[model samples]
Target chain A: MGSGLLVETYVFVLAVFVGFQLISKVPSVLHTPLMSATNAIHGIVLVAALTLAASVRTPGGIWVAAGAVFLATLNVVGGFVVTDRILGMFRSTKRSE
Target chain B: MNTVIQLLYLLTAVFFMLGVMRLRSPATARSGNQLAALGMAIALAATLWANHRFAGGALIALAALLGLVVGSAAALKVRMTAMPQMVALFNGMGGGAAALVAAGDWVARGPGGAAGAIAALFTVLVGSVSFSGSLIAFLKLQEWIQGRPIVYPGQKAVSLLLLLVDLAAGVALAAGNLGQGPTPMGLYSLLALLLGIQVVLPIGGADMPVVISLLNAMTGLAAAASGFLLQNQVLIIAGALVGASGTILTQQMSRAMNRPLSNILFGAFGQLRTEGGQAVEGTVQSATVEDVATLLAYARRVIIVPGYGLAVARAQQEVRQLMDKLLQRNVDVRFAIHPVAGRMPGHMNVLLAEADVPYDRLYEMEVINPEFAQTDVALVIGANDVTNPAARTQPSSPLYGMPILNVDQAAHIVVLKRSMNPGFAGVDNPLYLNPKTQMLFGDAKASLTQLLKALDEV
Candidate 1:
């Protein structure tokens, strides 16, 4: 559980490598969904958004933080749902028309 | 309890990685998306529990609920034709959220230290830029704004000046303390958003895939910067992962068009031909629907080239019907899918799939290219730029060196188009005028229906 700037950098770099290995193999047909899925993953920014909302004391800060939470959640929820819908359309040769 | 929260975060990151790995195959992609959603649920729960003591709990819940409802409803309702801008809008929102979070940190905690200040500034800058840039991309794709590149006087110079000022503000805020000026962060954030608009304004609608991908990467990096400011491992990991994904897609989309990312953003592609098609030296032979139907009905093999115009006219169903008819006539038929055929990467595949076109018959540019030479007739529907022979033959043309479909190699070429107007890139197609080419000009849907009727009579 120990943390520091260096540890955070390590996590970032390693996660990037993992992302490359995982996403590069996605064929062109699945690109939109993949982009969308990754977009949903980053909607984890809602973490920071929620924390910021909790920390704010003034009205202006609360409003800004609320906007943050809303947008992040929209990104998270919309991104995943749409990706699923798009993937629903993709049928291989085995599937009937 | 702190240790437990950190472990939950770790678990969420693991789920994310596993989910992305599963996305490599279409069969597993749906579950993969659901898995990532599960991870998001875990993260949300953990965040709620960790911040249990904080005020504004009701506000947070309300905002999140509204987001959930709105996002899901919009996602459920948006047509497949509008997917690119929908994704672009969501990307913008994420970026906006990141910027707001960073701004919140700066306003509340006053930067905390030099490193924190820098991270917060970066988050604010990149995130805001991504937000505005993506919104403009949305407007362009949606055609709320003109699809052509909108260049103004001193565009680059103004953007450079804005950057210099933003840099000055960022330095002052980082080197000194927050509240040092009458809104240093505000100035920096505003300038960043404007810079995004300035950068994206010159790029035409045809380059939307690259712009959207680039903005996606920017949003991810902005989230990571917020992670540094807040010291959150989950933010760092997930943000980095998406940053990498977006970067890979951006590069691949650029490669498909044979252009560098720099050229895409900076090249004023449609500016010169905004009035209409730049007349090339060739006599275009206009054909009746009967002539095309006769050509197609007699052909032994036919390859279809579709583009954004096909999507615009909602002719995917008509195209599928045409394919079936041609197959019944013992004509071998396949679709040539350019990587950038529609508004986004793999856009045509999704459209075709939605129309229930069998997957085996849809071929990518590289695989289907050589077949064009032997094809008896190439049926081009609402596609222009991709099938342009000038892209191969004219060096002075702006679209020179861009990889294009070799429809010119086919024994006979028949195009269904609305007018002689240029495509999204605003470049005239010489393919319309080639000696063997026959153009059937009308709205794509109406033209396809007429052609189908004529197929029986011819």
Candidate 2:
């Protein structure tokens, strides 16, 4: 138990490094799409909300979980769909079409 | 089972990383987004399986379905012009979810230890701030609220006081949890929300892109804090990725404007309407749509620069039509895109792309700036600050250090605007008064449509 927080801290620090390295090279042209796409990825928090939703033993818990799940899912679904729509515009195609 | 779930989470994190990395190019960005979505779906499925208590599955499914319909509708139906506000809304929702989830956890399980309490406190505080800040950003972008900075006497001091209270409450809450005593969770939550609104309310519309980017990073950090409370690795990974990417994007945008992050956040810019609406220091000239059309017809080369005005008028399609007509006359037409153009990064590109303009024809500032001198005609469409010669000539101007399009260097310049209203920064554009410049005053779309019609008769 004493070592748990330290382990999590190590994971957090390492992930921060990985994140900076991974996103450092994205071009300016793709920044909007990249932001939207990353916005979708952060919707991963929806899973936590859903996990909380699935164990609703009390009415209060049920409402809280449901609201969290809904917002999280909105972030996930909206973020991804919007990214896809924006990226569709960026796809190279014949000009006349 | 636990090992399998952890490995699945690990795999999801890898996919998330790959998604962002692939976005480095235009070619691979779509597939990268798809890959990341797949990771999210997988993480979601794993969470359901791992956390399901069997009784609440149906309700959970129902909530997911509701979210699916609402979110997809917003993403699918929103026009490209309004995409920045939509992004703000979505980012805010993510932050809202992180805050809500942390609160839910607190209600269900209370605090576990010093670490849990601290993580929970950070999550709620940061998440609430991101959520509220993003909401204000959305409203500003939507024009539901004033796009200009709304400031009051001692606003910064009040904000500072709120920050102090929030920090004190956070300490009390964390200490209480450590001592297994009563927590001041509600006080911290209220202060967090207030702090977010205060922090974002004074930033003007011109700085929205930077503000949105910063909020995006805050949401990511908040999500990571939620992951800490729940001991979840995938949330930490995805959140950290967004945090990093958003931070980098914010810095890039700030650099493009030649401003520091601190100034962008705290600078109550766009509030000074004092000198912007004043009489011009020099002679001003206005041109009709027909006059601009004739100029365009004979021009050997034309560069079109677009700003938020073009987006507001929904004129990209018409602008494209004008470009086509100019092309028919053997005019070499290209678009000059400033890095910080429009309300978001790559905003003008997306708007032009919607009009089916070839991506190749869009030239970034550095790539096309040198060609301005050679351009026979420079058409400024609803663009202001980016083309202001004040950036280059007037050192004391608010926009002095920012990079601007060299439209003033063109042989001929025509500006389409509704009025002489200053741009988001509320700084007067000397480019409007340049000797070679001509203003075609009207809504950008209407002017472009009229220009297209006049060209047809030419």
Q: Considering just chain B, what TM-score does every model have?
A: 0.95, 0.96
Candidate 2 stretches greater than 4 Å from native:
A93-97, B54-58, B177-183, B275-280
For residue B91, what is the lDDT in candidate 1? 94
Cα deviation of B240, candidate 2, in Å: 0.6
What is the DockQ of the complex in model 2? 0.71
Output the worst ten-in-a-row residue range by lDDT, candidate 1 chain B.
B270-279
For candidate 1, the docking band is: medium
Query: Tens digits of per-residue lDDT for model 2 on B209-254?
Result: 8998998998899999999899988888788878888888899899
- Tens-place lDDT per residue, model 2, A28-68, is 77878988898888898897897677655777677767778
Best by DockQ, which number?
1
**What TM-score would chain B of candidate 1 score versus the native chain B?**
0.95
Off by more than 4 A, model 1: A1-3, B177-182, B274-280
